[model samples]
Target: MSENRQIAQEIIEAVGGKDNIVSAAHCATRLRMMVKDKEKIDLQKVENIDKVKGAFFNSGQFQIILGTGTVNRIYDEVRQLGVTGTTKAEHAKEAAKSGNAFQRAVRSFGDVFVPIIPVLVATGLFMGLRGLVMQEKILASFGLTPDHISENFILFTQVLTDTAFIFLPALIAWSTFRVFGGTSVIGLVLGLMLVSPALPNAWAVAGGDAQPIMFLGFIPVLGYQGSVLPAFIAGVIGAKLEQKIRKRVPETLDLILTPFLTLLVMIILALFVIGPVFHTVEELILAGTVAVLELPFGLSGLFIGFVHQIIVITGVHHIFNLLEIQLLEKFGSNPFNAIITCAIAAQGGAALAVGLKTKSKKLKALALPSSLSAFLGITEPAIFGVNLRYVKPFIMGLIGGAAGGFAASIFGLKATGMAITVIPGTLLYLNGQILLYLFVNLIAIGVAFALTWTFGYTENLKQQIENDSKAA
Candidate 1:
């Protein structure tokens, strides 16, 4: 193999090696990688590779987009290595070694986050529809307000929405083991330890004290329920332990004895060491979050809230997502989470403005319905049909989005529950801050209207008059 091929081979090995791969392809900037199982992919190894930027999966494809200019070379090398749709038996003999701590950590990050995107969207949409149903009195007819049926539905959705994050360490554990060239089942046990109710309370104090529970000389790992790092670290320790025990055990007894011992040792360490360390980190991060929120509200909101729409438009919003989810898991609520709310509102406002102001029947028709959808917290219609189509609408939306974001930030608005629409989403902040979120959404709406009316509408009118004069 050439030098590049060697590098490519290493990259493949890093991403769970050839045996773990099921298929691969590339388009423009991303290598569309697919594994027989998402759990088996080693995200950390892939990310640590030189030239690799970030990895995320969407739909069914595990997308590995290199920073820039490296996609082609990597694509070529992967194909050359026969990872291109190679069968399991073909690469079985060439399986690489399970990676170390860093690699498993990386894998844990990817595994925990990527698969959850679809769920996030679904949850967002479901929440949005819930708001609509409530607003329109669709559910009121059923007498569902805090009633048994309503309570049950709410609980079910909340659990589903929270489950992925709450047990994230466990999820990460499964993926980490797969990446480490072992069965994911072992990682699942470690994950269970991280989130088990029986574990000492990291967030609760025993006896008139502020200190969290300690488990057998180890401080309890409190936030591991929605974390990736703790279990990821635990998996590395577990993998190492499994390897050692497997080596000493007799072949006949190895299968049963190795796993039995490995699970016990790993779980103990997780409870005693890895879990506590992660819990400490969790406490610190949560503290830092509160500290940052204490900054001048307007300035903080003006920057992140306003620019969030642009960030999403540029397709780099996932970077923000990483921050938001972490903050949510640790802090129980995130003040900055309203940026997405601002973004959706901004798009809707701009699209609505365009619908009202535009003379082009086609433009008005397209923007009108989509803008309505955006107001309800569905931006796909607005983004695809209106904002992306007309440069002015998108720009106007950005301006309004920023203004709204700043407004929400200044007021320190928070979503009481997970949702899509600004109104229902603002329930958490209702105490006096609700007014602020409302003001922000309104400002976003007004600014989009004013800008679109002044720019897109006037320009269109000017062209119409000129054409009429010419026709005369």
Candidate 2:
């Protein structure tokens, strides 16, 4: 057998043999397994296995840090050993079984929002480009003024950037409906009604150029353009309402009447009640986030930066994605991105220190590449794999992250984008602030590295070789 296959076999044996595995999945850098009984397996033996970097249990899965290149191979080997594997949906379902109400809400929000993140990423890239092209120097370099730019060119770019936010309600409604077991097409139709041309455009109403039309002579209604919660609530109500309505209708008519009544009832509820109430709620949430960001002298940034990775570890961090999208929509920039970048950088720095200081060759092999991936904005390898395993280095990383986050807020650092960070995030600051962005990364990395190397390292470095020896 190949060396990795040998290691994979050992991994199966180490984890209470193949019968203990209920399900398995792999993300970019870890082998995630949901096993039947915790007491049946030996975590120490798993750690001791050759080619394994680290292991930890999170959100109902025993995740082994196998890195990207190796995880797939090991995962495939285990699957061939005749155990049934699970999908991401199963993972989500498993995660749902384990959290508190707040954690469950956050994970559900992740299930709804993760599908929407890609388009937002694409839009953020365009926002950065728009910033790039609008620069006076760039326009001058191209021998054009703002007014001299063709209207057609401007309109095309505006469509590219604005479509996501303008129709964000539709996307959320669709995804939320899918998650809640509804027919997505009808959910989309209901979502479109919330933003249709027939209603007063929300931005225009807010800007005083238009007014909400009074529905039923007393209820005021306007377009829910760029709205989030109204669509989400509408989707849930519509979906559940459809299931309930379907039971009373005849089977032959069920197909036709179910979706029809679902959309119709939802449209009324959305326009008259859900839209008005949740729009207010969303505004409050947005305002709350703004108030936090506006806190005196970077306290908000420092607090968020320090705890952000800890939030990530809990697997509930997508709650802040709502705040972030709101920030980008209202302010046209996000300082949260800067704070998060610092948190990610600090993780990289701590991992690098672990890689450098450890006398064990296995530690060296895992930590260095994991550190590189962490610097590039993927921190699971560095955090779960290296720093968190060591304990103190992770704490040092939080301190470093806090320092970077405080500096980010004090400096008023802003990103024109969301989602991309560390290496790829350089795109967001290309409008003459790239140097400051790099500087933030440097400060985060330098402080984290210095502190971890200085105090985070323990004398137990030689023990990992015995615990996880390769030449077995």
Candidate 3:
């Protein structure tokens, strides 16, 4: 049998045969499944399977790390073995059913923002590149002064760096509408109206360059460029309103009247109510986040970095998406990314130490790749497959993360981006902060490596793995 086919067969038996698997799916690096009986599965046997990096139950799904390309192949083989296959979306819906209301709400936030992350990451990279090129020292090396740069070039660069944020509400609204089952085009239009040119620009109003339009000589109104809460709230409300209108409108006029009434009512409410109200709430949230991050002697960073991964284990880390977005909208840079990258790097470092120290070939095989994945900014494999499996290493990683976070606050390190971290994260720091970013990561990795090497690994763990390997 082919290697993937053989692995697939073993996985089926390990998970209590085909009868136990209700549905199966695959993400980039893991095979996800909903099983009928978790108690019937042989967890150790599944972990011992060759080429299976690790397996864990998370968010009501059994996830097996089989690496990137290998997972696709193995999933196909699993499908051929008579197990039902589902799309990742369908699998996520199933998983969502198991979480509490808060967890489901957090997951909904993730659903809304996940599609928007790539553009933000790209915009950040553009900002970093623009910063790099605009540097006087670098420009001097290239025999070009800031004054020598063309106005047209600057405008073009601004288009790249600023457009995503300028229309951030539209993206958020569009995504939120999609998530909440609304007409996405209507959401986009409503979002655009929030930042319509007829209204005073929000940044201009903040800068005292323009005044907000007063409705009834009382309510202040302005464009919501670079806003979050207002757009999100508007999207949710607009979606629900559209759904209700669709049901009430006659079938003959449904297409025209539903959209017309939805947009008309939404625009009025969004500008007059949601925008004026939620914008203030969002500003308060931003102020509060800044206060926490600016705490004395890096205390907040230390606390956050230490506990961040622990939160990841509970699967609620997506809540940070909103905070990160708020920071980016207000500050134009993300300090949170710099602090969190340290936490992510520490996990990789701890996993690396475990991989090197362990005599068990099976563990070494799992740990090394998992650590690499962590360094590349995806920590699930390292956290679930390696560090967390060995409790000591995970703790050491937390300490390392705290130390790095402390350094980050002391140095005032910030990134141009979010969603990417560790090695690939270096791109976000290219605007003259690269050296400090590297140092912070080194502190995280070095401390974790040293601590794990000294105290985390044990002969008993190696012996246990070897026995598990033999049993499999």
Candidate 4:
């Protein structure tokens, strides 16, 4: 039998045979299975399967890390073995049913924000490129100065770098509405209304260049350009309102009246109530975050870096999306990104150490690839497959993260983007902070590697793994 088929057959038996699997699916790097009985599955046996990096029960699904190309093939083989095939969305819905209320809420936030990250990353890269080409030294080498740069050229660059942030509310609202089961187009329209040109610009109002329009002679109103919370709240309210309207309206009028009422009610509520209220809430949140990051002597960085990966293991790391967005909106730079990158890089470093030190070829195969994955900004494989398996390496990585975070704070390093980190993260620092960014990541990797090499790995762990393999 082919290796994938053989692996699939073993996985079926390990998870209590085809009878126990209700549905099966594959994501980019893992096979997700919604099983009928968790107790019947042999978790250790599943993890021990050759070419399976790791296996974990998360969010109601048994997810097996089988790497990229391998997972889809394995999934196909699993289906051929009598397991039912399901889409990732269907699997996610099933998985979502397993988590508590808080976990579900966090997962919803993740679903909303993930689709928006790519555009922001692109915009950040554009900003970095613009900064690079606009440097006075570089401009001088080209026999040009800031004044010699054409106004039209500058305008084009601004369009590239600034458009995503300026329309951030529209993107957030659209995604939020979709996640909430509302009409996404309506949500997009509502978000656009929040930043309509008719209203005074948010930035201009903040900077005293313009004043907010007063409603009820007390409440100040302006365009919510570059805002996060207000748009999110508006999307939720609009979606819920639309659903309610759709249910009550007659079939003939439902199409017209549902959207009309949803928009009419949402627009007033958003501008008059939600906008003013949540805008304040967002500012307070931003203030608190800044305060924490600015804590004396890099204590905040040390604390955050040390615990960040631990948080990732819980699967709620998506919560940082809100904070990162707020920071980018307020400061146009994300120190949170710099701090978190250290934590991420440290995971890879620790994994690299384990890969280098282990005697077993199987471990060497898993650790090296997982470590490379972490360096490129995806750490799940490294964290779950390697570092967490050996507790000491994970702790060593945390220490390394703290060291790098401390360095980041001291240097005041910040990124021009969110989402992308570690190696691809270099793009964010291209605006002139590249050297400092490299130093921070290097420190994180170096410290984690050194600590894990010196103290984390041991012959006992290798012997234990080899024994397990032999038993299997």
The clash numbers for all candidates, in the given order, read 6, 1, 0, 0
Candidate 1 per-residue lDDT over residues 1-472, each given as its tens digit? 6766766886788667788777776654567666667787766556444445346544345666452356778877888888774433233212222245444333345444555555544544444444444442444677655343466777776775566676767777776676555667888877877777765443344232345455555454343566645776787677777888888999999989988998888877877777767756756765665666566746666666566766554443544445555666655456666756886788888888777766655556556776776787666557655675456777787777778777776766765334346655654454345567777788878887678677744676536533533442
TM-score of each: 0.55, 0.94, 0.96, 0.97
Sorted by TM-score, highest first, which candidate order results? 4, 3, 2, 1
The superposed Cα distance between candidate 3 and the true structure at residue 139, in angstroms, equals: 0.8
Better of 3 and 4 by TM-score: 4
Between candidates 1 and 2, the one scoring higher on TM-score is 2
**Between candidates 2 and 4, which one is better according to lDDT?**
4
Looking at model 2, residue 106 earns an lDDT score of: 74
Stretches of candidate 1 off by over 4 Å are 1-111, 114-168, 171-186, 205-228, 232-288, 314-316, 319-331, 359-362, 388-390, 423-436, 456-472
Candidate 2 lDDT (Cα, 0 to 1) = 0.85
lDDT of 3 by residue, 101-166 (tens): 998888888888999999999999998898889889999999999999999999999999889999
Candidate that scores best on TM-score: 4
Tens-place lDDT digits, model 4, residues 1-472: 9988999999999999999999999999999999899999998899788889888888889999998899989999999989999999888888888889999989988988888999999988887788788888888999999999898999999899789888999999999999888999999988999999999999999999999999889999899999998999999888998999999999999889999999999989999999999999999999999999999898877988899999998989888998998888888899998988999999999999999888778888999999999999988889888899878899999999999988888888888888989999998888788899999999999999999999888778778878876777
Q: What does candidate 2 score on TM? A: 0.94
Residue pairs with colliding backbones in model 3 are none
